[model samples]
Target: MTLKHGPIKNLDMEGMTMIFAVAKPEILKTLKVGDKVTFEADRVKGRLTVVTIAKSK
Candidate 1:
């Protein structure tokens, strides 16, 4: 799914919108299109992957 996220400072990336494959698709069931979230992503097998997610405070 596409996520509109701010800069991932840890990754040294600037803010932008992009597509991300979720590590746990089940987590999608708990999220809505516009919900603010904090997540961690990594390059797995040459793909940008969302490894963890949580509702933003």
Candidate 2:
């Protein structure tokens, strides 16, 4: 799995979390809104957009 570092915009009931990174959209497309992901950021560096999230059990 590729390691990505970015700012997490939002986290919903779904498993997915919206993230803002310098990475290209194509790379972002690969990630599902509800897919479990890991990121790193110091502060909010971007806008939070709506994303499909997975329900947590």
Candidate 3:
């Protein structure tokens, strides 16, 4: 999935749209297109990955 996100604090990345690998497949089940979310990401095994994610409320 391509995500357009604000600056990611932990990853030290500027806000930009990009594809991120989800660490858990179930994380995708809870989300759909256009849902706003707050998440944490990391470089896992040489891939940029979503470590934890949740719907923004």
Candidate 4:
């Protein structure tokens, strides 16, 4: 999945847009392009992957 998010303070990353693989692709099924979401991401097997995701309140 591709995400444009704020800096991940824990990862010491600057805010930027990027595409990442989703560990649970099914989670994306209910989302739309402009929806706000909170997700957990990580590098797995050298690929960025979204471990968990949810619609933001």
Candidate 5:
């Protein structure tokens, strides 16, 4: 999946770090820690970080 908004925090050869806010629970479920992802926020386009994953159980 692609993220439409977020701030690019850190980056490396392997991947990048992104800090974005999401509202949909369904979308959050599809993500996991260390998972590779794509970011698309306004003019920014590149890989992102699944640095952390939080869910309600």
Candidate 6:
């Protein structure tokens, strides 16, 4: 997935849009363009990855 995220001070990352790999590919089916979600991300296998994600309640 690709995301435009807020600044992540821990990573010294500025808010910017970037592509990420997901930990679980099945999760993609539950989402559509413009869906609001809360997620956890990290570097997995040296690539930025979304570890978990859920629709905003």
- Least lDDT summed over 10 consecutive residues: which range in candidate 5? 40-49
Instruction: lDDT winner between 2 and 3, please give it.
Output: 3
Tell me the TM-score of model 5.
0.33
Ranking by TM-score: 3, 4, 1, 6, 5, 2
In model 1, which regions exceed 4 Å deviation?
Answer: none
Worst 10 residues of 3 by lDDT: 1-10
User: In order, what lDDT does every prediction score?
Assistant: 0.85, 0.38, 0.90, 0.86, 0.42, 0.84
lDDT by residue (35-55, candidate 5, tens digit) is: 555542322344333434444
Q: Against the hidden true structure, what lDDT does model 4 obtain? A: 0.86
**lDDT of candidate 4 over 1-57, digit per residue (tens):** 789999877567788999889887788898898899999888888887888888999
lDDT of 2 at 2: 29
How accurate locally is residue 16 in candidate 2, as Cα lDDT from 0 to 100? 38
**Clash pairs of candidate 6?**
none
Better of 2 and 5 by lDDT: 5
Q: After superposition, how far is residue 10 of candidate 6 from its true place, in Å?
A: 4.3
TM-score of each: 0.84, 0.28, 0.90, 0.85, 0.33, 0.82
Could you arrange the candidates by lDDT from highest to lowest? 3, 4, 1, 6, 5, 2
Model 5 lDDT, full chain set: 0.42
lDDT of 1 at 36: 94
lDDT score, residue 47, model 1?
A: 81
Candidate 2 lDDT, 1-57, residue by residue in tens:
222324344432333324443333444555664466444332334534333322234
lDDT top scorer: 3
lDDT of 1 by residue, 1-57 (tens): 788888887677888999988888987778888899989988788788898998888
